[model samples]
Target: MSAQLIYDLVPLGSTLVYTDGSPRPPERHRKKLAVWETRNSGGRLIRKQAEARVGNTVLPASITLHKGDYGNQGTIVLRVHQTFSVNSDLKFAVKERPAIGSVLVLARPGDDAELVHLAANRADAEEWLTRHGYPRAVFREITADTVAADAVEGRAAA
Candidate 1:
C-alpha cells in the first residue's frame, strides 16, 4: 500500500511496515544489514502531518512512525521516529490495527492530533494519563463502526 493510503485509511497507533522489497542481508555483512534494516522495519503509526504552506515553501503531507526507543532501566533517552512523505517510494503494509474497545490517547483534539498511546481500555488509558503528563490529551475509543467503515472503504489491513 502507498503511504498516502496509510495516512488516509490506517488509524493512528496501528503497526505498519515499510520495505524496499529486498531480501535481508546476512549478519556477517554488518554494514549492508544495517542499511537494509533502515529500509525494512516495522513501527507504530504515531503522527500524520498535513500539507502546509510556510511562506514560500509548501510542506508535503507526511506520516510518522515510532520506530524504537532507547533507554536504560526506566528512563528513555532517545526515540527513533521515521517520517515518510506521501510520495515515498518504499512499499508500505498495515501490519496491525488497534482492536475495537481499545482507547487511543491523542495528544490533543484536532486533525493534527498525534497518537501518544494505545490502551486496552478506558481504565488503562486513565492509568497511563496519570503516569504520562498530556494535559491536552484526548481519548478516542476504537469502535466496530469505525472498523466496518474501513472495510467498506476497502482499507482492510494487509
Candidate 2:
C-alpha cells in the first residue's frame, strides 16, 4: 500500500514512559537518540542518518516523518530503526503518519521474533503491508547515494 510509511520509534527500556506524560525519561536514565531523515520531492523516503543499534540495552527508537503520493493514494510516514534491551510491551501515539515512500524497517521486535517486516521498491512495499502485516507502510527506493551525502557533509565539518 503506497499510502503512508510509518517509521515508528520504539525506544527501549521502561524509561520511555514515566509517572506522568513525559516523552523522555530523566537525564540520569536517558540515552541520547536521534532520528535524521530526508526525502525527494516526489515523497520518496530516504535515510539521512541511522545509528547502529549497539551497546547494552540501546535502541534507536525515533521515526523520520514524511509525506508522499502513491498513484491514487497518498501517505505520510518515515524511516525507523529500533533495538530493545529485552522483550517488552510499548505504546506510541503519532499525531501524524507518513504520506508514502520507503519503509526501511531497521529494527527487530524482541517480543515477536517473527515480525521483521520492511520493504523496498514501490510495488514491493505495497505488497509488503499486505503480506508482512504492516499497516500504512509504503516503501520507495533509497540508494546509498542518499546516505553518502551525509557522510561527506560530516567529513567536511570534521
Candidate 3:
C-alpha cells in the first residue's frame, strides 16, 4: 500500500490590512488573506489557494488532503499565508514509517507552518507536511509512492 494522508485544518498565519500598494513598505501591507478550498462533486479534495486581500499578493500554492472518509463524506482543509512572498518559499518532503506507524508533520521552524498529518492509520505525516509549508504537488507525488510501499509492507507485517 502507498502512503496516504488525512490532514486536519490548521491556520497558517495572521492577515493585516494595508491601504497602500507598496510591497516593500510593511506599513502598507494588509494581513487579510483569501482562504478557499476546491473539491469535486464527490467532496474529494482538489486544491487550495490563498491570496492577500490587498495588492496582487499570492501565497505559495500547496495541497492539504485527507485520505480517510469522513462519515462517508470526504473533506480537506486548504490554507495560505497572509503574505504573497511567503508563498514562494513553500516546499514538501516525506518519509515512510518513521519510527513505526505512518505520520506526517512539518519538520521546520515556526508553528504556523506546522500541520497535522494522519494516514489511513491516522498517522502524523499530514500534520508534519503542514508545519513545513510544502507544496500540494509534492505532497501528491511523494505520498503516492510512500503509501504504495506502505501497503506492501503492512500486508507482510499483518
Best by TM-score: 1
| Model 2 CA deviation exceeding 4 Å by range | 1-120, 156-158
TM-score of 3: 0.17
Q: Write the candidate numbers in order of decreasing lDDT.
A: 1, 2, 3
Local error of candidate 1 at 64, Å? 0.6
How do the predictions measure up, each by TM-score? 0.93, 0.25, 0.17
Whole-model Cα lDDT of every candidate shown, in order: 0.90, 0.30, 0.29
Per residue, candidate 1 scores C-alpha lDDT tens digits across 1-158 of 88988877778888999998999999999999999999999899999999999999998999999998999998999999999999898999988888999999999999999988899999999999999999999999999876665553655655
Please estimate how well model 2 matches the true structure, expressed as its whole-model Cα lDDT.
0.30
lDDT of 1: 0.90
**Candidate 3 displacement at residue 36 in angstroms:** 18
Top lDDT prediction, candidate number: 1
Steric clash count of candidate 3: 43
Q: Candidate 2 on 52-153: residue-level lDDT in tens?
A: 457665554322322332343444244343332122233223232232243444233332222233344456655655655544333333454432332342
lDDT of 3 by residue, 50-152 (tens): 3234567544434333323323243334433222232222222231232223333332334233333324333344555545555641222234354345334
